[model samples]
Target: MGPLIPQEIISLDWNLVIAFVVGIGFGFVLEASGFSSSRKLAGIFYGYDTVVLKVFFTAAITAMLGLLYLSLFGWIDLNLVYVNPTYLWSAIIGGIIMGLGFIIGGFCPGTSVCAAAIGKIDAMVFIIGIIIGIFIFGEGFPIWKEFHEAGNLGSLKIQDIIGISGGLFTFLIIIFAMILFKTGEWAESQFTREEY
Candidate 1:
């Protein structure tokens, strides 16, 4: 009864419009929250400011809870939802590369694009680097295709993997997030920096 796009309740064109609007809103929020600053992003790694961790945890938990509630209420069909297939080795390699990029460049792809939009020279350079990296990846896909396709685990959910209900897994995630939030607060106090 939900997932308007897949259900054809909303046309493809309108879905794209909605996506654009959401993207704009998200970018505005990020910029307003000082995510446009590379220093602010890098602060997470240095234990100076953990706003990134807090915000991310909040968003993830909120989304998970919201989806769970929606499905329970029959507003969304959880079975109709798509899950990305797990490619273990590629996923790990990709995450490691992305983590290194975030640590060194001080911005993930999304924040880098938002910062670049606001005329940040460093972010602009980072975006260019991203483009170059993507191009290289595209060109070398054949060479790494086998490795990328390795460890093919079909679409699996955390709840299924752990043999728990979605509700229980989400509740546990909330608890974990709470712990991280407390740790982040402590880290912020310990690594306060006046510059950024």
Candidate 2:
């Protein structure tokens, strides 16, 4: 009954339109939340400002709970939802590279774009670096193709892997997030930054 496009409730023609609208909405929210500021975004790593962690954690939990409820009520077909196939080696290497980039540049791809849109010079430079990185990766794809495709674990969810019900997994995640939130609050108090 859901996964609108997969169910044919929404036609393919509207996919890009929906995505564009959602992207704009997301960018607007990021800006409003002060995520456009590199300092604010980077504070998550420094343990000063936890708004980034709090906002993202809330979003994850909200989405998880929303999907759970929707599936429970038969409003959505959970099976129709897409799960990205896992590429183990590529994921690990990419995560490390991106983590370093985030720490150094103070912006992930999304936040960089959001800040760039608002005329941030640093974000603009970050976007240029991102483009250069992409160009290099594309041009050298043949060299890393084998490594990228080496660890092909098919789409797997935590609940399926751990032999638990989705609801139980969601509950666990909620508890974990609550603990993180408290930790983040404490960290902010301990690591208070005069500039931020």
- How high a TM-score does candidate 1 get? 0.98
Q: Which window of ten consecutive residues has the lowest lDDT sum in model 2?
A: 33-42
TM-scores for every candidate against the unseen true structure: 0.98, 0.98
Pairs of residues clashing in candidate 1: none
- Model 1 per-residue lDDT tens digits across residues 1-196: 8888889898878977898999999999999999999999999899999999999999999999999999989999988787899999999999999999999998999999999999999999999999999999999999999999999999988899889999999999999999998999999899889886
- Alpha-carbon error at 28 in model 2, in Å? 0.2
lDDT of each: 0.94, 0.94
Question: Candidate 2 — which pairs collide?
Answer: none
Error of 2 at 49 (Å): 0.7
RMSD of 1: 0.9
